[model samples]
Target chain A: MAINDNNTDSNKSQKQEEKDLPKVVIFLPPPVFSLIGEESFASNKFLFLKAYDSQLPLLQFLSTHSKSIKAILSSGGAAVNADILQLLPEVGLVVTTSAGLNQIDIPECRRRGIKIANAGNVYSDDVADLAVGLLIDVLRKVSASDRYVRQGFWATKGDYPLGSKLGGKRVGIVGLGNIGREVAKRLEAFGCFVSYNSRKKKPYVSYPFYQNVCELAANCDALIICCGLSDETHHMINKQVLSALGKEGVIVNVGRGPIIDEKEMLRCLVQGEIAGAGLDVFENEPDVPKEFFALDNVVLSPHRAVFTPESEKNLSQLVVGNLEAFLSNKPLLSEYVD
Target chain B: MAINDNNTDSNKSQKQEEKDLPKVVIFLPPPVFSLIGEESFASNKFLFLKAYDSQLPLLQFLSTHSKSIKAILSSGGAAVNADILQLLPEVGLVVTTSAGLNQIDIPECRRRGIKIANAGNVYSDDVADLAVGLLIDVLRKVSASDRYVRQGFWATKGDYPLGSKLGGKRVGIVGLGNIGREVAKRLEAFGCFVSYNSRKKKPYVSYPFYQNVCELAANCDALIICCGLSDETHHMINKQVLSALGKEGVIVNVGRGPIIDEKEMLRCLVQGEIAGAGLDVFENEPDVPKEFFALDNVVLSPHRAVFTPESEKNLSQLVVGNLEAFLSNKPLLSEYVD
Candidate 1:
């Protein structure tokens, strides 16, 4: 008895349909894909070609299939720069699974006429929740007290030294974008006085804005860095800014690591020049300074400000939606305009 | 040479004045005194008689100066029971340097016609700050991730598991009291959907009210216990409540520990019946279940939700104010009327 040719033909065409799908080369899998998984993107109109799966080297693989690459998916884990773009001359777009553009070469993408799509406003709530969490952790000593309890210090030693209160605190937010505004809203409910320092003062905002970050740091009890990492903002919180913040001041950074001078901040923390710090990002990720480990006044996280399950789901849908929109010649869901 | 007898006389007079001042017996100093020293109260018109200073025991010290004992300064550290009150025949007032009356015997004091003053509404902001902090810690894995980073897991292991989002979560406040209201206000800014369970439905309030704790837990993604420890509230959160809360639910207790049946909660956590817990108060405090120490999902803290440098300062004034008012025949500042 011969097997039905109909089933065989259907299977062949299914394979053909999957093979014919337009390619979006993933030179690097985003941290988001690690969270929500890339399985959802497979249901879309595009086929993701994972460059790492090829036995050939990254450059050789990119050059071997240059004609097939119409888009590049990037993140903080991978840099989509001029060299990578040079190999993929047919690439028309670059999509980043991150809120910031620091990982990707924006000027190069612009000069090459490549449209960029990013995770816009999808992670605002998650980042804001973590910003407030870190602030409270630093000021209220949540994690420090947790350590005390876990180590059985409460039974042996006693209550840890009292932490400062968040209420009535003057909190200055640097780079008051979506994440900053969300943080300000949460802090306001905690009865904190909110102020902001952006490159230029935002119109229609009620908060008191300072043109200078140092002035903002000087006046506020705490400074929360929510700015992007760029040439202007890199090491923005230098020694002078930290000195102006004074000994009783606290800082919470959910933004990029290098935005604050890490070495200067470490010295200030060690010397009691600043009261405490809560950092979600580091100057060099996965290579945090060992100095931060012993400090009770600091709460360190593994740069997970935007990795909540809800945000991850939202990001997965957004990433797939942006790629599908691009493949269908539709406007990007979250286009990154310079 | 004859020294000035006038200088000696002035010193003698000052000593006499201090000796003649009314004495308020301090049997056991509250934790507040640990944060802010007792020196502030020494400046008052009345002299605080430190019972621990005498060679005699607490009871003997109280009886030796019954005539001088018109008031007792008490705290969570010492219970103001009928045993202690019976020693002071003239004691008409009991002042606690804590927010809750669980540390004091209210019925015994009420029967003897003794007035009670507490740190009313003073620690509300501090407790609320910590309640939100613990909620954030449990939901966002703040303390867990802190440990992960502290143990240098991020370097060896890439990223910790994603935590749940606080926004759009149904947060059930167990008590609609001052601290609960404050917590609700803060969670609202984080975009949480708020409901409550109080003894009586509050008028002019808009949140959904569940009279049953189990029902509240059933509907909420998280439960924040902010009620006091009372006859009706003892072990209010039992096995049934934890079961109703299910596997996705989290809990935070800034209230007295006995409010939740800890053994049942522990079983639920161990069995994965409930997601996680953040506990500041325990049933047998300073002796937390060793099982909790090993659980990454739980964030343990000493009973310090009501403490902060700012709150301690406010409490110092309030404690002294209530005592001064009692001595001066003015109304008690924060009288706990039965």
Candidate 2:
């Protein structure tokens, strides 16, 4: 070797020497974004992994990658299964932008020691606002009014069915979390009596707290769901709850879809089991059952409770901040421990 | 006289039955009877006028058939113009359900001392509720959003523009009477700061008080018209006030239509002088200006602010009570003094 060849050899040796860097693989579901989804910088920073027909490609890529992949972020109704969690690169965190972690295999994440964080309190107010709007919409027959107005029946719509005003109604909340508290505040302003049912009664709130959903349903003129979804909560609002609501009851859901049994709800609505219902999240999203379309007493919005550009921007920024913190070995803003 | 023949020799039937009992004729507007019109009871009790029209045939018959008819009552929007007021019996009390005395020429009523009483403050809450609803509807773009959902736009509508939430907004009220106070209360619950301009500042209220409409408009993000309609107040919200509101302002009218300069409002709305408007009452009724139908920024509700059945029942009962009080030599529950 000549004198310059010695320097070249030294440069190659330095270049080959490297330390392990943490890798992040984000699984983004189809239609995960909204108008302002780009505002979430952290979510945008991760390497995107779309779930194709199979996770084989994902597993293959992760196994061969040299960087120590440590985290996975998924959004939308799409969930990460147990098998997928097993295939995930040795990671320390798996975060989701959902209030509920039903879709995530929590038990598997626990077994693997993967920390899980979710967008919990972040969307409470947004969902509560939708709940109130939906309640007002369905009870006031706003959809029918719109149809009547558009069809030029303005003059002949006849004495509009008077709606029970919000002033003197009893409202029951399924959960007493951030969303429930927000809803309680709003309903209190309207002079409604707000009661709540949770796993256990919260001592701090002034609302009448109950430990049973059926008891709450029996007492409240209207029922609103603002709880998380889980095996214990699955089909929690079943036939018994529906029957307890009686014929004059109004039900509004802004929580997970599986919390209420869709088939039972449909049957009750068909049989006039209850007065009306307002649903933001459904059993199946864009794939809403045809039965819902034909009902005049139901107000259905396609899982748009967490929409609104302001919230989206806020949530995105938070998500990005968390991602930055996680990658830097710093504490996440909302780190989750399985 | 024949029934009293035994004692007829004493008095010649008491001067021919008390001079024909002052033959009364009442000219009622169409369909004025059946407790529908606000003046039906007063017209019926006086027995001074005939109900001619089918809607008010009894009052017309009384007006036409009675020879010594000294009074008449007409209801609905049929104005007691100078011409019509002059044709009424000399001793007449012209009453109206509306707060405004314009339908009956005030000068004429004063000239004749016709003792007119209007159903004032009867629709204050209803009107105030509608004004607030209209404000929200316009600010929130409720109708537009409804259309967006119904039109299948969903999330594809390109964000739908982040609307200014009702919380933490300044609302300027043009009056501080029953309706205005109610509006202030409702807005207060929404986290809005309320200010008002009335005949005089109400120191009792905690809200900031302005002495002029222009000043109120200048300080407020939204200006609401709730003041009484009068010659002094007609066109109170003129170009100067509209200009004071600048470009990004909202106007809501639940007061009489003339209080706002309809022509100026049209020009401003067309030229983007204001952000949006909600108009329940108009300078003219039923026959709104064709241009009104063309504006997308304004909401029209067919002057139905007091259209709720609850309000209707309250109004009718109040009107009947006022009549009963008048007939029984008692003070009216709510008397209007001019």
Most accurate candidate by lDDT: 1
Clashing pairs in 1: none
Q: What tens-digit string does per-residue lDDT give for candidate 2 at A1-338?
A: 46697788987775454223345565554233545554344333355433443356665765655245667776755567776676664776777777777878888888787777777566766666666666665655554444443343554453234443444579999988878888787667555799999988787777888888999999999999998888888899999999999898999998888899989998999899988888877776545567766676887665666655556666666666776677777887876643
TM-score of each: 0.95, 0.72
Q: Name the weakest run of 10 consecutive residues (lDDT summed) in model 2 chain B.
A: B23-32
Per-residue lDDT tens digits for candidate 1, residues A102-128, read 988889988999999988999999999
Please, what are the lDDT tens digits per residue for candidate 2 over residues B1-338? 25576576556765565455543333444222332543534433343334453364443543444345544343555566666655555544555556556656778777876666666776676676667667765665554454444445554453344444565679999988888887887677556789999988886788998988898999999998888787889999999999999788999998888999999988999999998888867786544566765565776665555554445555666665665555556776766665
| Model 2 alpha-carbon miss at residue A224, Å | 3.2
Docking class of 2: incorrect
On DockQ, the candidate that comes out on top is 1
Docking class of 1: medium
Tens digit of per-residue lDDT, candidate 1, span B41-111: 55546888888778998888888998987898888778788898898988888888888888788998888
